[model samples]
Target: MPRARPPLVTVADVRAALWSLVSTAAGLGVAIALVDGVHATNPWSVLLAALVVGVGDALLRAPLRRLARAGGAVGALVLGLGAQVLVVWAALTFLPGITSTSWTAVLAVLVVAGVVMACGHWVLGARDNAYVVGDLLRRARRAAGLPRAALRTAAGPDGAGDDGSGPAADERPAGVLVVMLDGVARPTLEHALQAGLAPTLDRWLGSGSHRLESWWARVPCTTPASTLGLLHGTTDAVPAFRWWSRRLGRMVVTNRPADAAAVERGASDGRGLLADGGVAVSTMFSGDAPTSLLVMSRASEGLGPGQLFVRFFASPFVLVRAVAGTVGETLKELYQGWQQVVRGVRPRVSRRGWYPVLRAVTNVLLRDLNTALVAEQLVRGAPVVCVDLVDYDEIAHHAGPLRPEALRALEGLDRVLGLWEEIARGAPRRYRVVVVSDHGQSLGDTFEQVVGRSFGDEVRRLLRERPPARDVAPRGAASRRGRSDGEAWGPANTALHALRPGRAGEGRVLVGPDRDVPPGPPAEGASATPPAAQPEVAVIGSGNLGMVWFCREPRRLGAAEVALRWPALVPGLLASPAVGLVVVHDDEGPVAHGPGGTHHLASGLVSGRDPLAGYGSRARADLVRVAGLEDAGDLVVVSAVGPLGRVHALEELVGSHGGLGGAQCEALLLYPDDLVVPDDERDDVDGTRMLVGAEAVHRRLVGWLAQLGLREGA
Candidate 1:
């Protein structure tokens, strides 16, 4: 398994190369004309200068990347500002026919070269994703210096299905790449394919190289819950992205390292989807993967440091382009927000402050870095690799699902798919590319906007009392972040949110509850600590889903108990036009209540108007399962879904999930067709499947892997 031959130059490659040459010359000509004492003797000397610069860049970039990674983000900043110029100056010095009298002359050349490279890459790189992917993979492979034995697995012999005695999975070297496109609804995905927003995906489907299918993202439809099931075969693993864990007596936000680690400890069994030589990238949990990068749960162990900014800014061209893009995107957001204000775009959130910068980072730098990381994983010859691309999700949170910016994020992600597709063709082992979504986003006005108060405020209003409650942060987290944790991830959500006036509900803390009570009892999900002071109830919202739990009770308070404790609360919410349905776990079972009637989940007993109506046929069943969870809220409140398919999000997000309604439950999966039943043998089977829960999706994914000669254990 010697290193594979380099791909032959194609028209695209030739075009890029030609553009590079022309841009270099253009920059050099400017430098010669503008600099005080800079000259190239002949036209050939100019060509030599450009060639030498390319060689200098090639020689310096790897070390620069190393230096950037070692220096962390500060190193990347230094490299972006001056390292490319150093390479340019060094390259200029090599030409015997060229002359630079002073350091200023060299500086002028260096600056011009920097501008040229950045501009050239931006213009060309926008057209291609494979170039970046290939370069990253080559470098990762070169950096690895893997063992000779592992290198032999690159072209391992193909084997048949496991019969019984022989281990076919061990003998075979086929792999699977699962790409989770965050918050992409099936309806939106089809819209993107048809509207030419996702050209690469459209091409694949149109050419019949792939098949598209939709799956139902179940109760508490969210990335944390969905990914938990997919990776670890654990349904009901997470109650919600953010939930009240009475057992811990602290707020559990899955994205936080300690919280994620705690949840993973409870859920993973070492035989997860990634148990066998798998790699996890940019995920909440590692799924027992031997190697995990940018995974929240593994971060506690110092697995993958926050080196994305460092690695990304190491390239001066990328840094300059990204900086420009960030500014442009910031302006675009300001314009778009103003446009929305004037035009009155239905169901949009406030887009202001650091969000624009955050948006640019997620949409540009983060995406590029994540793709590079995945390419590195592929080069490492891992059996399985799963990565989450969150560009669209972040945009849609504020812009709404169908907005131009959100859709554009989808288009950029399509290029990422193309990169992975190309990588699979020459991977160390036979690989199949499959795209999935943890959940989908639902478009909506926020509950506060519709209901005239935030969910917390509403709860307080209903209680008619301001019971003292303390802010309970996670064990390792500060009670107050002030937007700076001061680590590799020191300047993330904390710093960003600190700049803006904190919103009542969400749009504030990105993790954990704003208020919580001390531990109640030692039994049944309660912490060991004794309660000092307790809030009457803890109210937390995940998108459209709102959870209310009585702080004094270790167990879920039943419907009767809820009614007894706060008689006016459920009735008052129902009378309000903003409320849709309120679900409560009864002594008998989970029951749904509406403005008109009550529907028991276990018995299908409808007393008045069926509350779950318009929510879909599966809503009752999903509720039944969610209600059974140990940390299930005492009362689950869902905001009204408007006539136009809008569910009012309990959080500040415009396009949100973690509740049933609209397209939030509908997830799209785009996978290679040949792998899932042979192309010739199967019918044109591209449609939606009723994957009732994330658990079902987990089974389906494991089955797909089994078809690829992988073990079906997970």
Candidate 2:
């Protein structure tokens, strides 16, 4: 855990002091110009008053914030705006710019200053990011946990390139920074680079300092599965993002903290990508890193909005900047969504209800926080640092992956990458930066929108059944809202969940939670789970992939038995134009049935039309791998892929992933040019050698660590 930051007047302190001085000066100037509340003896008195006000806040604000956080309904990570206002009031009362006798006039200045300053920052548009960027960079040096006295540097926020005169190097191995830009495909990144959206990376690649290679994100192409392989070097993590854990008799949605921990325990065996000495930031799994920030699996580590993260968040104008960004981003989403509807953009999902808010939080707040935490570790010379930037992935889910809003979010992620690059210049030891994506998103209309009903509803229609008592996915929107539950560990309410006075232990993953939980167990199966005690079959997943599980069966049901039971369910699903294939375990092994023919997996026999036709060359192998997992569903359904690379998502996302279709599996890896790949792990794809599967990518990453002398071997 990161220790409490010591009190010192450092770079961040100076910059914050400066920004406050300016903002407060502006506020006091407005009061002196427009009101009779403040009287200045001389011109310098306004500046003096601003500095005095900053000092007052510096002294009294924290205590008032603590009191409010402890005494009221306000969350721990709340802005403490009231406390700040109080400090401003108290400071102005004693300053030459204000009279202590006029409380009403003081109140007038407070409201006017608050509104005007907030408006000023908001209208500053993109320039407003300076607040977060400068604040984080300032805190980065101090947060690195290295000595401050000798850490003089020419490379920093205001400058670049190390001066070779700083803190003495420790006798430790060089480090690697592995960054994941979630749901960004290889092609998308190429487009971004070409469009000059990611100038730094483009320059690096052009300068021959980096090599961008295409990779594959295999079947069950979801964050949980890919994250597991990337962090733990294991492929058989949970069967899907949400799965029935037979051992634990509960539905495991890896997005949930406790469930994430369970999945990590099942996959990890002591050593992981960051196991030696590193940090994991804003990722699903910890990679066995000694320090984990915003990692779901390590919720017990208990950093959250507690003192450590709060100090970083509570820094002057950091939260205000985020709040302003959040508001602007939310409005942008609303306007964009409205424009999409008005312009009749096809294959779009509704960005209504809580989506706009979620998008703003993910893109603005989480992105900034994750960047800050990762930058801190880099400056500290950590052996391995892994971080995830979900800005693109989150927005692309609602807005189409190629839409302007989503691409704009992608551009912001690129800027963050550039910031990290800039920060890396001053590190004590040399570091190789490797950037990759967990999975890519495919765009199209949702399955429900296409068919005018959900897969669950379709299954129920075929089987003459009603909704299960407590199904994880409801009959509505296949893009179940629960996937947005990020992590319990953060600095704000959106970021941190454990803020309630007595409910700190029960972290809030709630905004619009329709968590994927299973139906009640069958009366017969001893090892089955049900949310409310009603036994029934379930059709889950809201992406391109859908899974059918029979709660009545203790073990997975075979194709022959399923045909014997609900004979119409299989044939009914196969009949839908939205469905491409129905995969089920057969007597001869797993069999895939398409509209035209059947493909037998075990012997690679095609009775007629090959079921894996347009899905891609790797579809068969990917399906074979997923179908063979221990907890795979009784039947797997994949939406049809159109010639235009369009897919019908099982859930309610305009852009989606989780099965074979389009660019969803087309991931990328941008690594340092010096890293070499062995011949055996490379597979030829379209005449270019590409790394296949998440496990293969993991091996390559491990090799890089060994090559850097951070670990024993690849």
**Model 2, span 358-377: residue lDDT tens:** 78888877777777667667
Q: After superposing candidate 1 on the true structure, give the runs of residues whose Cα lies further than 4 Å from its correct spot.
A: 1-53, 60-89, 92-131, 134-173, 303-316, 467-529, 677-688, 712-714
Those runs of model 2 whose alpha carbons end farther than 4 Å from true positions after fitting are 1-20, 27-43, 53-90, 99-128, 135-173, 304-307, 475-497, 500-509, 515-534, 712-714
Q: Write candidate 1's Cα lDDT for 403-439 as tens digits.
A: 8888988988988876665444445555667888988
Model 2: weakest 10-residue lDDT segment is: 482-491
TM-score of each: 0.80, 0.84
- Number of the top-ranking candidate, with lDDT as the measure: 2
